[model samples]
Target: MKTIIYCWLFLFIISFNLYSIKISVGEADISLRLTDTDFTIDNYNFDPPIKETYSVEWEAIDNMTYIKFNYTGQAMGEKIARGEKRYLVLFSK
Candidate 1:
């Protein structure tokens, strides 16, 4: 049916819109993905071959954006155990 074909086409287009950006920082390779409401970051280290994912939520208020995340992993030859951080960014335009 034409309806079934349209549904499949819509799903195919939506899947391709989701993308990620990858970058290397020091000994870690990080991938970041952003959607309408939230974003996620995946960090992978080559030396110890460890991978960790950090999921966080963001909200925009006027010209400022807020982000908060809680993560636990290894860092700088030592274990992070547990840590959390909050960030506020202001945009100028």
Candidate 2:
């Protein structure tokens, strides 16, 4: 009985690790964690500096539209000068 319970627990842990995501940049860090205890986000931001700029985007992806919103602790605006750093962490509806 003990062996059966242990085996089931191990399998459950493996399944939880598959649907998790973590995003960050070199100096900037961001975390979007959902605390349902059903899904896990385990450092899926395997890369740094994930810049998804819509500088000249003609339309949205999958027929989606993004309206105005704000992201605290993040730089969310167009460039005024030369290179520095920008980070946006919100895509609201």
Candidate 3:
């Protein structure tokens, strides 16, 4: 019984890790975490001059997901911008 529990626990851990995606560029970080019905992306900007945060919500549709994300923290839409500016993403699962 203990061995069976340990095997199940290990498989759960591995499967959970397989669905998470993380990417980092410079001081900005983006991560996508998947759940049963939907997924959420957390965007973090850790730049020295500016620190901002954004969120992306996606819903599953058939074999794909639809996301409309935008960043609200910007320095007057200048050279340095954050997040998606009226952009849409269709992620295929």
The estimated TM-scores of all candidates read: 0.40, 0.19, 0.38
**lDDT tens string, model 3, 1-93?**
000000010111235365544434233444444443322332233343342334555556676545434444433343354455222333332
Local distance difference test scores for all models: 0.42, 0.24, 0.36
Best by lDDT: 1
Q: Report the lDDT tens digits of candidate 2 across residue range 1-93.
A: 000000010111225564222433233333322332221112223332122221211123465532211221212343222222223323422
Pitting candidate 1 against candidate 3, the one with the higher lDDT is 1
Q: Is candidate 1 or candidate 2 better by lDDT?
A: 1
Worst 10 residues of 1 by lDDT: 1-10
Model 3: lDDT of residue 10: 12
RMSD of each: 14.8, 17.8, 14.0
Which ten-residue region of model 2 has the weakest summed lDDT?
1-10
Question: Candidate 2: which stretches are off by over 4 Å?
Answer: 1-18, 25-70, 74-93
lDDT of 3 at 63: 64
**Model 1 over residues 1-93: C-alpha lDDT tens digits?**
000000010111225676443433334454444453333333443455333434455657886666555554554556545555556633332
As for candidate 3, its clashing pairs are none
Cα shift from native, residue 47, model 1 (Å): 6.0
